[model samples]
Target: MILVSGCTGSLGDTRTNDSTDDPTTGNPTTGNPTTVDPRACEDGTVRPGRAPLRRLTRFEYNNTVRDLFGDTTDPAFSLPSEDVGNGFGNDADTLSVSSLLAEQLSTVAEGVAQRATATPDALARLAPCASNVSPEGEEACARTIVERIAPLAYRRPLAAGEADELLALYSVGRTDASFDVGIATVIEALLQSPDFLYRVEWGTSDPEHPELRRPTGDEMATRLSYLFWGTTPDEELRMAAQAGELSTKEGVRAQAERMLEDPRARKTIRFFFDNLLPISNLADLERNAEAFPTFSRQIGALMREETQRFLEHEIFEGTGTWASVLTAPYSFMNGPLAAFYGVSGVTGDEFQQVQLDTTQRLGLLTQAGLMAGTTHSNNTNPVVRGSFVLQKLMCQKIPLPMGDILERVKPPDPYSGATARERYSQHSQDEVCRTCHQYLDPVGFTFENYDAVGLFRTTENDVTIDASGSLPGTPGTVSNATELVQKLAESEEVHDCFATRWAEYGYGLTLRGEDTCTKQAITTAFKASGYNVKQLLIELTQTDAFHYISVASQE
Candidate 1:
């Protein structure tokens, strides 16, 4: 996780001006010490840093199989659950292969092979010469099919020996059964290959920098497609790789621009936010229906869709800036969601765009889905809600509450005359609780106007709600959700935190001290571009961190 310490400062400052700096590390003068250029530490030196071999996440596997064989069965759904790292399941470090998973892969591969060759026409499409009467013609057709499909499945051109080995498998199946069986056998083998299961990336030494290395064109294509599309490269992208179009920054940008315009890019954008805000958990969210009569499993599904639609409109249809997303005063809602928000004029199942009352709602923080998802089933929990803002939005590391404190911080009593705020005020009275809640409770208190299920409420037990709080190091205090969101929108710390999250998501690694310079360059460009998300993505693709690798020795 990236930890932000202190107030926002100049990200681009690469000079040391401390007088106590050692002679070997600072300026080499005796009389008066001057600022030393930090870039002199071999800045921009490309090296082949560590790139872990990653297995395809469940989503990636399902999507790639869908694209490859047009199978919509979602085979990976039956596989073992993946361990999440760096806030995403796709992180290479956590995707381990277990014995059960290996067995399931073989079963899935066979099932997919049967589905792909279910009909004569489907088999014909896959292997054109399968209908040929002569054995010689059938063998020739099998070779052609292997040669054509293996590269796409492997994501690189297959070696001659590899192709021969696959051909040998087909020949064995043909002698035992028939031509179609031979084709299905080949498909099963290819699907089970490591080349199909894992994304393999390694770097070759760069001539200009002997110690550094760069990804080959094919490897670059795979990286770009997975980063932007969350699946394998299409035929067009594969052609570009084979033609060496991914070898330069300009070439990569052209492909990225084209891919962004495609509909598939929407999937990647949604995937990022789904994990970031984590709407996926809402699908299975359980609530006390007896207490909150209107809430149900169906309402939870609608809530997820509402957030996705709102995000899509803001990101793609509107200006696509961080400011627009944070302060947008509108949301897309269907009958179920509209009823929950107490908004009128929207009926039926389809989500319609509704203008929000700025006094009541502002951006994602006020959205019913997020607000409801963050709270408990029966009542609101200030610590959970406040900790989310501090850690995820602001990138501050708040230590988890210990066992003793967790035992003491009891839930607020709803039937009591005390309001939610009054009931939870014990934190300020205890030393152990006050240490963290001093920073958390205030931020969470701003959302008290929304109940456990995110319905607007003015009072609890007939007592007025106090949605007032102060953000540490920020000027003034906010009294409501809208003011808090507006303050966050104007904060440089929030902007840098957002940028840091994107870097972690895009690069698939935790940001370390060595990455500060690269992150600074990206954040500087992000600010210069008015925080346009699309432009920020384009800028990230061109950074040295994306295009070149650092030497392992340096790492």
Candidate 2:
């Protein structure tokens, strides 16, 4: 009766063939695509690659428990921290369990189970058994409780032996203690099960395409809920799965649309941007008090909230376009941030939408949070700022500097009669450093107007700042941060890169070579939707990548 937790191999253990042959051109009767007709595969019939088993991240765990049991204790805070993969904490491949984590899970499960059954109302909602019933009736009530709650906890129907095992646990508890004790024991066991801790998605074989497998309705429902709502499926979503509504593209779209309109959608959207822009890390940003006399943790927190509020207002309340996100002339600011941005009339602690002076601020790229996070404690680091733009915004994979190259290529001192721009120019001089800095430094130099703390400045060390720079392959030169954001707003590469990033985040897997067709389709649809962020999310749920899974031959 040992329930084996589904511990698969390492992240890179799975091997996928990088065949260029399209699956659509193959014979329908046979699972082989033809090599002759290149156009036959262009109809977008590629099978989706398989996603590894995903463990819920700390944030996902907390949100899930809060939604699942109306518990707000945030027990996952005691769990080990999660590693970031593909720029997101939810990557399926990187999330793994260790012996320490297993012990932590067991301990947390006991506390959560006890809390869930703390009162008669709570016990009734969860187990619905009579307190003063006879022993036989108590056993019957325990069985009923196990049968009712296990599916929601596991996110799927129990297997043949699962219910009996839980009932057995309940029997031990009833004999040893009380009926409530029996139910709590079952609850504790279910919480620690692999089915609860991991998103165990295994697709059923597609009869029409034998080589391809489609996720079960329950699996798709779980995918949609976690992706859009950041929690387990609600009653309507669970009903949709049971009724087979999640099996069709139209069904998935309807649910996605409905969920997107709900208030939870705003939380999900904010979570995505929080990972994308990574403003959440600002809470831990350190600064020198002498260098930044006014900086404080309170200001750091306010900066994060400002960015989140601005994103939500634009995507949900306004037009929701990428252009508006990058070139919008307004932002949300509070008293502290307003002072930092050099804006007036915003006097309260609450964040209010204020129009920006086009000369200084433009879009998210110029936000104080991003500028401050990508800088050093005392002075601005153009290399860090530039790398953030190229790697995060454009999806370029920049290699890290090896050995002493970083130590050697240092910024010039302000007292040495050099501007920040002039200091970073030293990287371009050394042939070893120029290989990478040639691509990074130029783009970072465009943000010179914003200091390390993200305050707008005209000069450093009495030298007029030079914020002019150019992005390679872009049409025009950017004289300042405003122009840089505008130029990025109009670039097709930037749009597609953003699309690629969202795909990775939404799918919970890195975009591989085999995912080229699906990635391109998402990018195409994203472009057609006028780069609307909300529309792009709905469109992602409708793609084959979201519905179908590739089946291994042995399976």
Model 2's C-alpha root-mean-square deviation from the true structure amounts to 7.5
- What TM-score do all the candidates reach, one by one? 0.88, 0.89
Name the lDDT of candidate 2: 0.77
Report the poorest 10 consecutive residues by lDDT, candidate 1: 8-17
Candidate 1 per-residue C-alpha lDDT over 1-555 given as tens digits, one digit per residue, 9 for 90 to 100: 222222111111111111222223222233423222335335654422335667888888888888887888999888877664656666666678888888899999998888887877777667666545367688788888899888888888888699889999998887868888888899999988999998866666788876666777888888888878878899889899889898899999999888887888888888888877746667677888887888877887888888888888887898788878888999899887898788999899888999999988988788878887777556787666776776677766554444566555555455542666776675345666566667777888899898877888888767889999977658789999889989888877787767877776677655544554556667887899888888777777777777776666234
lDDT of each: 0.74, 0.77
Error of model 2, residue 208, in angstroms: 1.3
Q: Which candidate should be chosen as best, given TM-score against the real structure?
A: 2
Candidate 2 residues lying further than 4 Å off, grouped into runs, are: 1-44, 128-137, 404-406, 410-417, 553-555
lDDT score, candidate 1: 0.74
